[model samples]
Target: MIKYLLNQSLLSMKKRYDYDVTYMQDILRTDLGAFMKFMAFQTMSTHKGNLPVEALYAARIRAIIWDDCGPCTQLIVNMAVEANVDSVLVKAIVDRDLEKLPSAISLVVRFTELVLAHNPEADELRQQIIELWGEKGLITIAYGICSTRVYPALKYTLGHGKTCSRVVLNDEPVVPKKNPQLVGSHHD
Candidate 1:
């Protein structure tokens, strides 16, 4: 596990969160209360609406991949899986096989990529996003994508980032259909 050096003031914030602040919370709060509020806004703002959280998560995965923030990439991958995103969808995202994804979700990924790359074609993609997601949904998705990018720079600069986790990215089946220990073992 990556460890953050927290000071007395940060410790107080951690205590308020029941001493269970997330990795980003610990690091951002290290700066001061205002920075923590900024971080909070980025994460919480989009979550206030009924937008598809899975699509937002998918967009995040794509953004972090483009940013080459390994730890954030791995963290988002784990989160997507835990959120019960379809394994096939998660695999497609991890594999960067965008064509394998549904057009609706893949549109968000492509838009995020183009935006981060600052390609002029991103405007075209943004238009497409607006058509599919509506202006409000487009705004939500765009904000979510941009917001997620900030954490990678922070973690990478702070030396808290790691190479993307293979265990998290691997497409290997996480749950066994049958218990290996129970195979050929006597059971009532």
Candidate 2:
């Protein structure tokens, strides 16, 4: 009975976003307990305590792009758009056009990049995030960054992930820029 409801939910999501959910289906079929745990972890990504929708989604977009360049990235982009994040800001992040992004979002992009790259240079940026949004805000952004990576990782590990594909925004296809400027660079 629970699986029936879960499948209905997943089907709705798949239809709404035009996203593939075979990995999630596989997980559900293989282990109900693991699927439940995975769904619980997904809740962590949705908590944006005190963050501007733009800042939180920026961190999520950046982190997902770091881990994936294909369907997973497209899913995040689609979700961000649905949440009403500014389309221009979403494009800038997708294109890695740091120059076009506002200061707050630029900080988030660079910070997410540095954190993903395992560079300690993110320390100063972390301080800035806290100053602007408090500890909960920082935590929200951290969760955004961390949780976005899991879907792609799980998909690929399950052999259900795809290679890079064009991402569509507002009905237009966008070729996301690869490796744009990061912290300590002239763009900053």
lDDT tens per residue, model 2, 1-188: 99989988999999998888888988888899999999998789788788999999889998887778679889999989999998888999998898999999999998888888777789999999999999999999989988988888888888887666878888888877656444334233
Q: Which lDDT tens digits does candidate 1 get at residues 1-188?
A: 12244345456755543322355565554655655576467565345244576678777777766665345565566667767887678767666566898887777766666666566777998888777667877777777777777776756666656554432445463221122333333222
lDDT at 2, model 2? 98
Candidate 1 Cα deviation (angstroms), residue 27: 4.5
Model 2: lowest-lDDT 10 consecutive positions: 179-188
Query: Which pairs of residues collide in model 2?
Result: none
Which residue runs does candidate 1 get wrong by more than 4 Å? 1-31, 42-50, 162-164, 167-188
RMSD list, candidates in order: 12.7, 3.5
Please give me the total number of clashing residue pairs in predicted model 2: 0
